[model samples]
Target: MKIEIWSDVMCPFCYIGKNNFEKALEKLPFKDEVEVEWKSFQLDPTLHPDETKTTFEYFKEKKGVPETQARQMIGQVSQMGKNSGIEFNFENAIITNTFSAHKLLHLAKKYNIADKMEEALFIAHFIDGKNVGNIDTLIALAESLGIDKNGAQQALTSEEFNDDVQKDFSEAKNHGISGVPFFILNGKYSVSGAQPVEFFTGALQQTYDETVSPLKSLSGNENSCDADGCSI
Candidate 1:
């Protein structure tokens, strides 16, 4: 079975959904048969690398919400993240463009370390509060994950993966995906957002069964992020 996930590094729910999906996949007998691909999607493409702000400020401005509401929304996500063993430090998170980070992900895919690159990027943005948009930061992240430093740097500098990233965007549009952390299983079934482990386990079982049997239904909720904002 093949699983293609469309997500952005900056989306909190993407990290949460990844963890949930991983936990569910681990319990399956056919885990080894599953090929997971991480596709890039940017929730805030208009952001600039040079522009820096804390997540609180970014949320306030982007949603035109008051400070209390912004903090409350972030608190909800932070609490939800804890359920998946993630420690989200929204206070220190730096808001910036993720185009370069997505480019690095394509480079990581070449080396079969795209999963590690995705996790490292999530940790850098949500936990360590690193500027993922910076070239040095992305190069260092790629190197830390065993990708060749010069190769990663050259890819980013030369925009080698720009088309790959754009292709992901186009695919998302075709699929009517306006949110991060969208999962496509075997190119048939999909589950949106950071659903519980049980939901993923059930979906996986149904999808897997459908491979040998007939098609079945998959159910889940959508707690995803898009251009407007994240759903609470």
Candidate 2:
């Protein structure tokens, strides 16, 4: 089974959803049979590179909300993140373009380290107060994850995975995904938001039973009769 997740690195719910999905997978019967793919989705594409706007300020200015309300909203989200074991420091988080970061994730996928890279990028921005949009910081973080720094640097500087990232984004649009943390189970069922672990476990089990199981041939034949058994 393949599970594709479309999310943004800076999105709090994406981090939480990642943890929730992992937790659910831990108890899944076919956990080892599952392949997870991370897709790219930018919440704000037009953000300037040099912009130093905090998350609260960006939401306040873009949504026309008062600063106080924006802070409260951030606090609420931060508390929710704490419940999921993520330390979110929205006050120090800088809103910038994530196109490059998404491209890096594409490269990470090739090395089979996409999940770790995604988690590191999220922590760098939301918790560690690092600029994930910066090439230097990204290279350091990738190196820490055992990725070749030179290769990572070249990948970031060059347009290596630009087309691939855009393809993921286009696919998200085709799937009518308007938010981050969207999970597509077995490329058929779609679940949005940071759903609970039970939701993920149930979906995984249901998909496995309906599509991946060997007994699927017995699904729609209530009146059928076999050589050894007969039913009305």
Candidate 3:
């Protein structure tokens, strides 16, 4: 089974959802049989890379939300994140474009390190409050994950993976995905937001039940005898 997740590195819920989903995966019976693919989706694409504003600042200026309301909103998310074992430092979160980080994810996907890259990006932005939009920061983070920094840098500076990232965005829009951390399980079951662990566990069980098929003879019908009838 393939599980594709459309998310953004800067989205707080995406980080929380990652942890929650991983927790659920840990207990899933068919977890080893599942393949997870991380897709790109920018919550705020128009943001500039050199943005110096924090999350609260951006939300306040862009949405006209007051400072206290923004803090409350972030506090709620922070509490939710803590429940998932993620320590979110929203106070220091730098609001910037995630395009570079998303591109790096496409690059990492080539080396089968997409999940590692995604987690690194999330940690950089949410916990460490580093600017994921920065090329050097991205390279450093990738290096820490054992990913080739030179390769990552080349992919970052050039237009490489740009279209790949955009394609992910386009597909998300086509699917009417208006939010981050959207999960598509086996291309059949869709889960939105950072749902509870039990919810994901249930979805995993349901998908597994619906997909696992009993052995059948495809070439021809086998001779069988039952109380009701006998067939050849």
Candidate 4:
């Protein structure tokens, strides 16, 4: 069974969903058989490079929410992150264009280190508050995962992998995905949001059974909805 996740690195719920999915996999009976793919999805493609906006400031200015309310929301997200063994430091988080980071992820995927890179990028942005949008930081993180630093730097500097990243984003749009953390199981069943571990575990089991038995329909009689934020 293969699971493709379309998510953004800056998305807090996506990180939570990733952790939850991993936990579910740990307990899964066929954990080793399952293949996971991390696809790219940018929350804001038009984000500028020179923009030095803090997450708090960005939310406040873009959403017109007061600073206090934004801080409260960040606190809530931070606590939720703590529950998943993630230390979220909202104070140091700086919002930047993630297109380059997504490109690096594509390179990591080619090296079979996509999952590790995803986790590291999430930690860099949300926990350590490192500038994941920067090429230097991305290359350093990739090198830490045994990826060739020179290759990573060249890939980052060049336009290579840009088309792959864009293709994934375009495919997500074609699937009507308007949000991060979207999960597509075996290209049949789809789940959205940071659902509970039980949900993911059940999905994996169902996917596994369907893959093993071709006579079974994964969705059964359930109606599949478009990606307009509908419940599964």
TM-score of each: 0.90, 0.91, 0.91, 0.89
Question: Which parts of model 1 are misplaced by more than 4 Å?
Answer: 212-232
TM-score (C-alpha, index-matched) for candidate 4 = 0.89
Which stretches in model 2 have alpha-carbon errors above 4 Å?
216-232
The better candidate by TM-score, 1 or 4, is 1
Give RMSD to native, each candidate: 12.8, 3.1, 3.6, 9.5
Candidate 2 structure quality by residue, lDDT tens digits, 96-207: 8888889889989999999999988998989888888898988998899898989999999998999999999999999999998999989778889987888889988998
Report lDDT per candidate. Answer: 0.92, 0.88, 0.88, 0.89
- Put the candidates in TM-score order, highest first: 3, 2, 1, 4
Best by lDDT: 1
Candidate 1 — which pairs collide?
none
Model 4 whole-model lDDT (C-alpha atoms):
0.89
Name the candidate, 1 or 3, with the larger lDDT value: 1
Error of 3 at 9 (Å): 0.8
Q: How accurate is candidate 3 locally (lDDT)?
A: 0.88
Q: Sort every candidate by lDDT, greatest first.
A: 1, 4, 2, 3
Lowest lDDT block of 10, candidate 3? 213-222
Q: Give me the overall lDDT of model 2.
A: 0.88
Off by over 4 Å in 4: 213-232
What lDDT tens digits, residue by residue, belong to model 4 across residues 150-172? 99999999999989999999999
lDDT of 1 by residue, 104-153 (tens): 99998889989999999999999999999999999999889888889988
